[model samples]
Target: MKRHLLLTAICIITITLLNGQAQAQNLRAFMQNSGFLSLQTDTPYAETYLSVPGNSIVYKTGANGKYEGALEVTLLYLKDSNTVAAFDKYILRSPEIDDTSNITFNMLDIRRVSLPDGVYNVQMQVLDINSTDKEPLTLSQGLNMHFHRDSIDFSNIELIDSYAPTTTKNVFSKNGYDIKPYVFNYYPTSVNKISFYNEIYNLSKMVGDEDVIINYSVKHVQKDAVASNLFRFSKQKAAAVNIVFSEFDITDLPSGNYLLHIDVRNRKNVQLGEQNVFFQRSNKNSVGELSNISLLDVNHTFVTEIDPDSMVYFVKSLSPTAEMYEREYISTILQKNDPKLMQQFFYNFWQKRNPTEPEKEWAYYKRMVSYAAYNYKTAIDYGFETDRGRVYLQYGPPNHIDGSDREPGAYPYEIWQYYKLSNNQSNIHFVFCNADLVTNDYALIHSDALGELNDPRWRFKIYNTFKDGNGYRNFDIDYFRSTWGSQVDQYYGK
Candidate 1:
């Protein structure tokens, strides 16, 4: 029986997979800007999301003369490069792609798969399931699988999307745990809290009747000896494949590499077992400490514009420019109750960027602020406070936008397209949804924006399945496949 590897981790990378070399190197389909989520294998059941490029698969005109593709995917948990254990599956797809300019333009076909635990070199091959005249396309890559076969072990740490007690047995529910997994490792400033899942095992073997104190801490790992504590908590629980699910507020922690450090100990405080799972944070508010850098005002000419109410809107307006100043620095400045310094710093901020015409620059941005307020503001929230408003202020107007209204049975959503939001990203699209059914306060649900919310399962979010506690609809995957006329693949143009 196949266990669904349904752990969703958002990972983004640029690919021009028009050739065999590009096709041979990767199997990921819609990963955005995060690392692949790791899954532990020792459990009786496990699941994850995997993908293959549609173009990589060989296709042909059927007996009916319609183009079709078939793929066979297999994973061999490796003992070295040699296979130790294996799982395999076959898939047939009808890609109704009209863009014939590039034969590989149908886009990647993502699928779910299951496997037994071992280190794996994932291998995949594709063929036209109907026509057998052409050679099949093949690719392979190594993956680390710590299927926690240890006597005293833990499951792979799962970043939680959401979880409630199981009321229904579905894709998101397992072993009395109804949990959804996030698609990315990098958490930005907007993500204030982090929730995750891990399972403890063989505690009955390590200890007898007495309960043990289990501790878990999120430590910001540094190159130096000092690793600051971001969050710490402990609990007492019995031994077994014990489910350990916890959430921590990482909003205050500086952006960097961090590890969730876990330790199991006895009543004497002696450690029984320990493990760590590493994750990266890209919160601009948490990026780096920039409190000391002074913008030397050769001419403090604009000092007259400084005042107490500047706190009311100046930094609030400059929230889009979070890359320059740390959140703590700004918060610290605001808390100090010093109006003059804040104004001086604010004036220097505009002057440094546009020395000759600082007023012109500030005025133009303020117009964007006003525009955001007019378009995205709610009864209580300013435009800049809303997701669409913040995105408007930060990235300016999108060059193109698609899907202005809700689908027949889907949530109200808009797809904003940017020609080039950053040096590394081109033609990125963000999917914003009015999940609350509000008119002007659409939240940024998912995007391919380089450093934005790059949820891989956007279709799930767009369809509101996540609200009902399911990762997807009954046949949403099949629905997405049937609807891609020609416009869908345009979002991923090279």
Candidate 2:
């Protein structure tokens, strides 16, 4: 009986030691080093960490305060839309590390994986055996890593033809001031030697001099910075003149998005033209891989990309809905009973919204949609819900604007001014004056007031006239007669 009791005690002590060893080997904290950050292991037990770029790592613990015997790690490289799902799965299996008492377990080795040259994020998880301890710790990290390839001369890349250059209007306003007119277009990349041509005779109407200053900036998506180069062009003659731009080689740039801006100004340094454009260069394969390159479709009116084949395909995917209007019809759509026509509707919908190149317009269009969804989403949300958002998306920004809560004579009013008018400029003023006024007695209404109201049909008021031995008769209307809705009209329109 004595020998049996001693043996049992020894066995129980050995089992307890084994359990403690397992508990100490559990995961502590997951560290993701993006080639910029560093991770070190300090746990009592040896650990192994496995990783794949763009995927999260999960660590689970058991009820005994540790993982089972050996932990296995699976690495998955996500493709395209699988990002979110992968992240969620990782989070579902993560383990909770109790740092309250400062009792830390072993840390796994840090694993580094190469990622494509683009924006990406990595998540970490600790999977505890207890279902209750499965809380994942997620962190967002980015890698602006450049995937370089052997420099191949792109001199052979040629522009067979270019998109027909178009022009449109944009307005820039500060306080109550209006800037001059300006035109914008996508910088055509098909041709080796690019040039911009313009005539400036009509510009004299806004500024005393015929000369205008042009400023430009290039947005490089991968770099997250604007190009330092700025160019200036002076308009001197009524005759059409062309200026050639510096040669560009996209061979070194990563496959991603880009944008360019063109601002036209007069001698006064006032901004005449400020236009934003979006462009994208895509390689079906990785950045280092020699792959087929394509340009995304843009929908802006004046902006056009050189790839017409893609443009035609992009235009053929619009679906006609009950929301269609006469003005929304496209020349590309004539099929009354085409089954594949749904795609064509997609094309037309975007084509109509194109302010420049299809791709350029598409970016802004999506951004506008996003802005609307963020700012104006309601139980009944519409794309054109807010007046400010509508004007912002459709016409960019206004040149001149005035706003007041009071009516002109009784309430408030706002006025907008535009110094330059063209396809690019539309100046507007918003007036808010109460049309109703009860006088003590008789009052000569100003004739200008009658015309100002624009319709003898509507009720009128008197301005600068005397009533009850007092001179005060100024008539006004509170309705919106000008285009783009009056400032007060915006209140009612909303």
Among the numbered candidates, top lDDT falls to 1
lDDT of 1 by residue, 317-404 (tens): 7766543233345676677766655665666667756889887888888889889888888887878888888888777888876764
By summed lDDT, which 10 consecutive residues of candidate 1 come out lowest? Answer: 1-10
Off by over 4 Å in 2: 1-342, 348-357, 372-390, 406-426, 430-494
lDDT (tens digit, per residue) of candidate 2 on 413-479: 2233333322232232222232233311111111111001111211112211112122112111122
Deviating ranges (above 4 Å) for candidate 1: 1-300, 465-494
**What overall lDDT goes with each candidate model?**
0.55, 0.30
In model 2, where is the ten-residue run with the lowest total lDDT?
A: 1-10
Steric overlap count per candidate: 18, 65
Error of 1 at 348 (Å): 3.4
